[model samples]
Target: MRHAVTLLCLLVLAACARVPGPFEHDPSRDYYARPRTDKAEVAISPPRNMPPQMGQRVAATLAMELQSYGIVATVAPADAPIQVDGVMSTRDADLSIEVQVDWRVVGRPRTDEPATVKTRARPEDYAEQSERLISRMAQQAAPRVATLVGKPPNFIPRAPGQVAAGITIPYEFPSDPAADGTAAAAAAAAATGTTPTTAPVPTKPAEQQIKVLVAPVTGAPSDGNRQLYSGMRRALGSSKIVIVDGAGEDVFTVVGAVNLTPIDDRTGKLVVKWVLKDPAGKIVGDIEQSNPVPLAAARGSWAGFGDIVASAASEGVLELLEKAINRPR
Candidate 1:
């Protein structure tokens, strides 16, 4: 009876066992996605109230030291979102040169406390020891500056089939007096039954065109300012908008500002803001383009790349112009 019971128990266990085939996965969970740990980027402006060469060295050293803490830092202008500005001063007393640097972070809702670093060197050794002092100051200020920034927000790709509505501006061609004179001569010939030397000019109603003057771009590195300026003109030329050389009573002005922030040694974030103004200098609207680009591309010549950027941004620019045109003056 005990053997019979044992056999029955074994049969019951076998029946309860699950057959293994393939492991089931939840479709809702991403199996291949990794956690994002991207850190914020910081910009270090050249130190003020100091010699130009020394200021440059200090800024460069500070950037390098900040990178040691896993922070991507670059020497850039004041337009960057997280900027570190330093005012340096030197004092000579008792045959010794004392160097002091006050570092401040500029940002919204600023929470970082300003840091100051000071070092002294003998008058004879000031030149040779300046570098060491600068490096030391950088090391001390980097940690405090690092606390001022955090992980940057993730970038989301735009959806497909996204496009702005087309805007039309009213344009009238300038009257041509020479063409008018030719027409008069032709008409006289026709009436007097004599052949005219020049052919008659055909007259038609003035067609629509919008004249826009693209101002030189600001805050771009290398030759990017000029490249973007010409590129914007080229992009606008394709539409009904006429690119003008200068601002006039009938012309609209487009001003651009480019801010490049290094995200890493290899990559950077470029933000281009285009502001449109009417002939009277009244603000129309602004369009912005932000994207991640290679650091080399951002810092180096924009050359062929500027055209691509302008083309991508032209649509929004045109849309803004359209809105301004439709708006009641």
Candidate 2:
């Protein structure tokens, strides 16, 4: 009897097995299928009165795949999640069951970036394709969540003797504030009482070797161009940036140029072509890359050139260092 029942089940499957060929939508031939996902926690909701079987199957597979990729999904009883029904459409040809199942993955967006889940595919392509789609969706979504919640702590970076703007900072200048003051009153007071007047030495400005010659930048704005390197160092939490003056023992040098490029007919951004040259002026490293910056909507400003240059320089140096350190021996 069990053998007969097994034979009957086989016959049923054989009958249902479509002879692969071009199959069109047949409203009269439509049949309701069962939910594919059998797991109790995943809630699979299908489009209303259409057919839940195909959708349920698709949804279950999707939920399972999402779960595999670290998303939480569950299969539960009917009347579960009441999301809008997704439309399932199909076009079939010999050896193919081209099914488009449009449904939402079980949760919110990646990066908290909202996305409306719409999926289409060949259902006959084995369960892997659907699961693969779910995997991809979840993979994409995870980063967005991480980004929204994983921002690093705020750090108040300060220069070697510099203080942040709003707070009182302990300044560590020379101990002799009385006579070292550049003001005329302090100078005259020292000179008044035979106060062993020795010309006070001027403390040197803090210097970090730029170790590079990025630009002579001889166009409309020169000093502004130089400020790019200066500003970048500040942003990178490094005061070690020094402007090259041709007399540093650090023989390694990175020379570069920033060009303005047209993003579209009306706008442009900066690009840098950098060369790393040894003391003998032989180029060791050469490359070209773009630097993206936020442009102010104001019609004429370089349109926010100051912030762009600073950001560009910071990124370029950071890239150079990362490459330099990570290069295989």
Candidate 3:
């Protein structure tokens, strides 16, 4: 009788847990089933509740996997062809964690159903399993994505210096340094039928403003970091940028990773890599800025480090502004 009672309890516990399964689909919505143009790029958002570094690793891994199939991909910030977002949930069972990631294409009527992974709750296990699952998904999805956004549209050949409107060549960053800066200039000039003499000079450019949320700096001395954070806020505010609590339409987020390496007893080099992402989780721009600082000043005991961060913030904001100008509409 006792054995029977224990079995009943175990059954009840198992019933209480929510088992993982494939994503649900609405049959009426066949948007994803329909053929479409190939996306030029893909941006993957990190899974929630994971360490930032780990999440980035997953995205980067997925990006590489997609690239192998001839698709351009990155962890979010710059405007891209598609966006990927995901969530992770835990259940009472030891191996009941579930993760799902969805792919969204701009102007598309339907989003691709999410690919998911279910595994034991161990953090390390989750990471490894999720990586494999994501890699597999990327490989499976790439051929379809490539086919959809298949070919560059046909256009009449023009003179060497001639420009054409409504025509674009999909470009990815960090591939060619010179081309990276030219994508925007080329877009702006495409409307005017004139070859850009230099990187685009915005004529009558609108006051470019975006709402931004700045995440706390990592790997910096706390006391000095607070001062630097405040100084950065002030500098960005003066540039006519509005700081926001969350992402929304016309909103962006700024995140950073900082490393302070001591060069001597008192002086050190602070390396800051800042990334800016638009509301869709597209990377807009990034800046890797470094400055020398005195240890005392870096700990907020002196103002020297604050000044340096303030200047760096201004420059970072300027880069975002340029990205905004060049970003696809």
Q: Which candidate wins on TM-score?
A: 1
Query: Which 10 consecutive residues of model 3 have the lowest summed lDDT?
Result: 1-10
lDDT of 1 by residue, 282-325 (tens): 88777777666555445544544565566667777788778777
The true-versus-predicted C-alpha distance at residue 181 of model 3, in Å, is 40
User: lDDT of all the models against the reference?
Assistant: 0.59, 0.36, 0.47
Best by lDDT: 1
Native-referenced Cα lDDT, model 3: 0.47
Residue 105 shift from truth in candidate 2, angstroms: 66
Q: List the residue pairs that clash in candidate 1.
A: 171-209
Tens-digit per-residue lDDT, 227-266, candidate 3: 3444454455435465543467767777766677898886
Off by over 4 Å in 3: 1-209, 264-266, 300-304
- A best-first ranking of the candidates according to their TM-score comes to 1, 3, 2
All candidates: TM-score = 0.38, 0.28, 0.34
TM-score of 1: 0.38
Report backbone clashes per prediction.
Answer: 1, 18, 12
| lDDT of each residue in 190-209, candidate 2, tens digit only | 77963444466666554332
